[model samples]
Structure formats: C-alpha cells, structure tokens
Target: MARIGVLLMAYGTPRSLEDVEAYYTHIRGGRPPSPERVAELQERYRRIGGRSPLFEITLRQAQALEARLARLALGHSFRIRVGMKHSPPFIDEAVAGLLEEGIERLVAIALAPHYSRMSVGAYHAAVREALARRSAALPVAEIRGWGSHPLFVIAVAERLKEALEDLPRQETMVIFTAHSLPARLREEGDPYETELLDSARRVARVLGLDHWRFAYQSASATGEPWLGPDLLEVLEAIARQGEARHVVVCPIGFLADHLEILYDLDVEAREAAEGWGLSFRRTRSLNDDPLLIETLMALVSEALAD
Candidate 1:
C-alpha cells in the first residue's frame, strides 16, 4: 500500500523569550519590530507562563491524528508531520522530510479552520514553493478550509455548551471571536470574514443561541482599521446595554491555547469585561480534542478520495 503524508501547518510561536525578536521579524517579512514592540510581546509571553504551548499542543494534535488514522486502517498507511509558517520545522523542511520518507502522496491542512488568502492560502503557497524548490513532483491535495465541517461545528459547540453551563443562558451574552485581519481584504473580495461568520452562525444554531455576536480580536496595531467590532469594544457595548450580566467568549478561530487565548482573551478581554461589571468566561481551546482529530481524519479522507 502506498504511504500518504499528512502535513499539518500552523502559525508558529517562539520557543522562548530569546526567540521572540526573530519570530516577530519573520512574521513582519524580515523587518524587525521596534524594541518597544518586542518588549511588549515578550511581556505578554511572560504573563502567559513564560512561553506559548502552541508548538507542543500542535505536536500532540499531529500525534493524535496519526494514531486515529492508523486505527481507521485505511488502505494506505499514514505519516503525519507538522510545519510552521514563521519558525523552525518550516514548510520546506517538512516537505523535504516527507520526500525523504518516500511518501507516495501528500495532503496539507492549515490548523486554521477558516480560509483567508493571507492565512490558509499562504500555507498552501508555502507547500507549493517547497515542492518547486526541490523540483519534486508529488501528488498533493490541500484543504483550504473546514470551518463548517459538521464535526468541527460539533466540537466548538460542545466547548461552548460546556462553558455556558455555569452562566445564566438568558442573562449571559455569547461572543464568537476570531483573529482580526486587515480590513482591506474585504475590499478585495476575501471570503475570510464570510467564512468566519458562517462558522459562528452554525455553532450558534447548534446551541440555539440567539444572543451571540461575532467579533474580531488580537488585531495588530498597524495604524489601520482591522475587522470589527473588536472583542473588547463588543464587551463595552454589551455592558452599556445592561441586558446581560455575564459574557461567554467562544474563539472559533483558534484551535489551541496560545497567547491569543491565554492573554488576549483570558487576561485582556476578561479584565475589560470585569471593569464594565460583566462577568467573563471563555470556552476552552480544542487542542487535541478527539472530535477535532476526527474532523481532521474526515478532511484527509475526503481529500484523498478526490
């Protein structure tokens, strides 16, 4: 049987405080951030237990998916590898490793569920560039997005339901959030915003939630308007309404616990909500959740079938 390579790609995080500058520079397209910016980011990491567990969580996810695939006993065996967009074990390195292992075919999926030309599109582009660099002709399949996949919706809904158990359903406001992108993408006809809202809508429908609102979070300060209403702004508005006493945040865009979830939502947004006299709680991340693994398996199977 032929062996299939599954490449899981994600936006990488720095391994340590010392690596933050380089990681930021890579994300900035080789332009180093201001010293103040670097310090601010390092501080955020410091507050979040000195490092982001995103890399480890992503590795665990890969391991779990590979094991699950083995149990499926699909005709072809599988090898799962992780690649980072802006860090070591990069896309090119993973592609080369897969070639070295003599895998007969490849399937790549970004950890992100929603597709944006700047996000999932970039991952696919990296894979193509890597193959070109090696002049290796390999059969490749790329999953652009799976936000609305049934299992994915269930996984997120499951987490949201769990979080809602402690709050008064009618009195608590649910805010669905994702990372913000530059507003310019909308002008260019990007489907990113549409896909994100659709996923949020599906999850809301699953829970029969009528009070949930979608917002964007963790937008970089590039002196330009990103997606909105921002999560913090939304919280303020909810506070003014005096309708809900508690707020439950569901970050459908992120799949793991990282700075965005740990600091941005847990610390920043929580504090903002508290300041406005509104209780705040965020749904737990879906890192290595069995349902998420199943969702990944389904995506791979569908890709291979095509």
Candidate 2:
C-alpha cells in the first residue's frame, strides 16, 4: 500500500513581533541583520496587527485540502501538512514529519502561483536538503508553477469582477500585481516574469478587460534593482494621466492574506495611491477560496498520477 503526503508551502511569518529578527535572518540566508534593520522589519510586522496569519491560514488550507481529498475516497492513504520557508515548521521539519507518517510518496506545491528561481527554486532546494539530511530517498513530485491553471485564472477573474461591480468599468484600470523579484532574473533568463504576465493576461481575457496592466509590488530592500514599474509607480502614472477614476489592484501572485497583502498592498500602496489622489482597492485575497482549494487538489492529483 502506498501512502502519499501532500505538503503545502509558504514564505512563512514570525509568530509575533519578537520573532521578527529570527525570521528576517532566515530570509537573509543566515546573514544577521543590523539592529536598525531588525527594528525596521519588526515595525512592518507591528503595523499588521503585530503578527501575520500566514501560517494559520496555510494550516486551514492544509486541513481543508485533507478533508477534500478524503471525500474523494481515493482508496489510498494520504496526509497533508503545511511548511514554511522562514519560520517554525520549516520545510525540512514538514518533510521529516511526512516521513514519520510513513508516506512513501510526496506531492508538494507552493502557495505562490508563479515560479522564480529565487522563489520556487529555493523551495525545491529546501526539500532536497531536507531529504538528504534525513537520508530518505522517497519518490517526490511537485507542480513548479500553476499560474495558468484554468481554475486559477477563473478564480482570479471572478474576484476581479466582484471588485469592479460598483465601479464604472471604463473609468477603472485593473492592475494585476505580484511580488517583485530581482531584475537580474530577466538577464538570467528566468521564466518568472513571463509566467506572471501570462497569468495576468489569461485572467484579463476571461474578464474581457480592456483597460488593464500588470505591475510588480512589495519589492525587497535588498539594495538591488527589482522588477517594475512598481504598483505605486504605476498608480502615480495613472493618476497623472487623469484617465481612470479608480485603480483596482489584483494580486495574482499571492494566494493568501499576509503581511504583503495587509501592509504592502493595503497600507503602503494605499498611501501611495492616496498621495496621487487616485482611488485604490485591492481584490480580496484567495485565501481558502473553494476554487483555489480545487486548484491545489488538481495539482496534487496531477503529481500523484505521475
């Protein structure tokens, strides 16, 4: 009998303000942050209720996915777990737990819809390291990118439609956004940007949207050039044009509400939009959206079939 393990992975968040430094260190790849830098990071978490619900939301996702799978009655033993990249229940820990559950096969996917070497690639590396450290050579598979999954596009389009219902469609410009990555990925020929654009385009087509554009958001302060024109930059430009009365930002890259959605989009970006005298509203995050769960289940089934 073959038991399967389905692991859901996310970027992770600190449990509380006090854990921000440790989380920051993990994100920096173990480079300890300066005191000032730590304070700045801590403040961001503080603004978002002094904590992030990323892990909790991901746990709910895992639980929901498990129940859905059980309903399918696949007649195979299966278990689901949530893992984080920069917090407790790290990827290695999740993998170890799956092994302990006697799962002979693994199916994994990141909460991120798109892929970047800096993102999904890092996740793959973490899984490999975890497996190697445990001396476990198990069959594992993953869906590196599901940005163009039909259900995913439909889910996004539905959300966009719901957000635009009260606004004059022609007077609004839909801005599809995703977390920014380093500009170097372009020179390195990473497929991340292209995939992101593809997802945005598909969702727009589904909605039959005419006035829409894609922009990057939440760039890191890594002292390197990042993908842009940023959401704020785009909003400022749109305000200058005086064409659209409202700007709706749909974060196609993120699937859940976290610091990025709460602070980056709602707080920071909203402030920028206000400065430009432009109306700003972000689409509700796809946290536990039934369609999103179905999308994940499809990915798991695809991995298991292979």
Candidate 3:
C-alpha cells in the first residue's frame, strides 16, 4: 500500500516571549511591529503563562490522527506532519519533509473550521506555491472548509451544551464567535462570515438554544474596520439589555487553545463581562479532543477519496 502524506496547517505561535517579534514580523509580511505593539503582545503571552501551547497541541493532534488512521487500516499508510503559518517548521518546510518521505499523494487540512479567503485560502495558496517551487506533481487534495461538517457541528454543540449545564439557559446568552477578518473581504465575496454564522446556527439548533448570538473577536488593530459586532461590544450590549445574567462564549472558528482564546476571550472579555455584573464563561477549546481528532480523520478521508 502506498503511504499518503497529511499536512495539518495552523496559525502558529511563538515559542517564547523572545520569539514574539520574529513571529509578529512573519505575520505582518516581513514588516516588524512597533516596540510598543510587541511589548503588548508579549504581555498577553506573559499573562497566559509565558507562551502559547498551540505548537504542542498541534503535534499531539497529528500524533492522534496518525494513530487513528493506522488502526483503521484504511488501505494506505498515512504520515501526518504539522505546519505553522507564522512560526518555525513552516508550511514550506513541512511540504519539503513530506516530499522527502516519498509519499505517493498529499492531503492538506487547516486546523480552522471556517474558510476565509484571508485564512484557509492563504494556507492552500502556500501549499500550492511550495509544490510549484519543488516541481512536485503528486496528487494533492486540500480540504477547504468543514465548518458545517456533521461531526464538527456535533463536537461544538456538545462543548456548548456542557458549558451551559451550570448556567441557567433561560438567563444565559450563548455567543458564538470567530477571529475577525477585514470587513473588505465581504465586498470581495468572501464567505468567511457566512460560514461562521452557519456553523453557529447549526450548533445552536442542536442545543435548542433560544438566546444565542454570533460575534467576531480578536480583530487586529490595523486601523481598518473588521468584522462586527465585536465580542467585547456584544458583551456590553447584552449586559446593558439587562435580559441575560450570564454569557457563554463558543469560539467555533478556532480548534486549539492559543493567545486569542486565552487572552482575548478569557482575560479581556471576561473582565468586560464581570465589570458589567454578568458572569462570563467560554466553552473549553477543542484541543486534541477525541471528537476533533475524529473530525480531522474524516476530513483526510474525504480529501483522499476526492
């Protein structure tokens, strides 16, 4: 049986505070961030325990997926490698490594569930560029978006339901969120917002949620309008309405625990909610969750079959 290469891509994180500037520069397209901006990001990482666990969690996900595939005996052996966008062991490096392994075919999937021209699209573009540069002609499959995948919806819904178990559903407002992108993407006919909303709606329906809302979070400070209503603003509005006593946030876009979830939602949003006399709780991230691993396996299978 031929071995298939699986490339799992994610938005990377710096290994430590010292690496923040380099990581930030990479994300900014080689333009370094201001010292103040770098310090601010470093502080966020400090608050979240010195660094992000994103890299480690991603590796564990890969390991689990590989093991699962082996157990299934799916007619072909699978070798899974993780690639990060803004950090080391970059997409290109992963591609080169996989090619060196002499795999017969390739399958790529991003950790993000929602598809945005600026996000998942970029990952696919990177893969294509890498292959082009290497002159590799192996059959490749890229799983674009799986936001509404049945297993994915069920996993998110399960997490949301667990979060709501302690809160009074009647008084709790379920807020589903995703990383905000530039608002211009909408004008360009990007389905980023639509996919997020569709996934949120599916999970809400599964949980029979009556007071659910969708919001965007972690928008960059790029001085341009991004998606809205933002998460903090939504919290303020809900608090002002005096209708809901509690807010449960489900970050459906991200698949792992990282700066955005740890700092943006947990620290910043939680502070805002508490100041408004409302209890705040976010659904636990799907970091290496069994269901999430299953979802990845399913995506790889579908991509291979395609």
Displacement of the residue 305 alpha carbon in candidate 3, Å: 1.9
TM-score of candidate 1 relative to the true fold: 0.99
For 1-306, candidate 1 gives per-residue lDDT tens digits of: 989999999999999999999999999999999999999999999999999999999999999999999999889989899999999889899989998899999999999999999999999999999999988898999899799999999999999999998777889999999999999999999999999999999999999999889899999889998989899999999999887999999999999999999999999999999999999999999999999999999999999888
Higher-scoring candidate on TM-score, 1 or 2: 1
lDDT of each residue in 1-306, candidate 2, tens digit only? 579999899999999888988888888889989999989978888888898888888998998899888887776778898889999899999999999999998988888989898999888888889989999998889779899999999999999999999999989999999999999999999999999999999998898899998899989888999999898889988999886989999999999999989999999999998888888998998899889989888888877777
Residue 216 error, candidate 2, Å: 0.7
Q: Tens-digit lDDT track for model 3 on 13-96?
A: 999999999999999999999999999999999999999999999999999999999988889988899998989889999999
State candidate 3's TM-score: 0.99
Q: For model 1, give the 10-residue run with minimal summed lDDT.
A: 165-174
RMSD per prediction, one decimal?
0.8, 1.0, 0.7
Please estimate how well model 1 matches the true structure, expressed as its whole-model Cα lDDT. Answer: 0.95
Off by over 4 Å in 3: none
Pairs that collide, model 2: none
User: Cα lDDT of all candidates, in order?
Assistant: 0.95, 0.90, 0.93
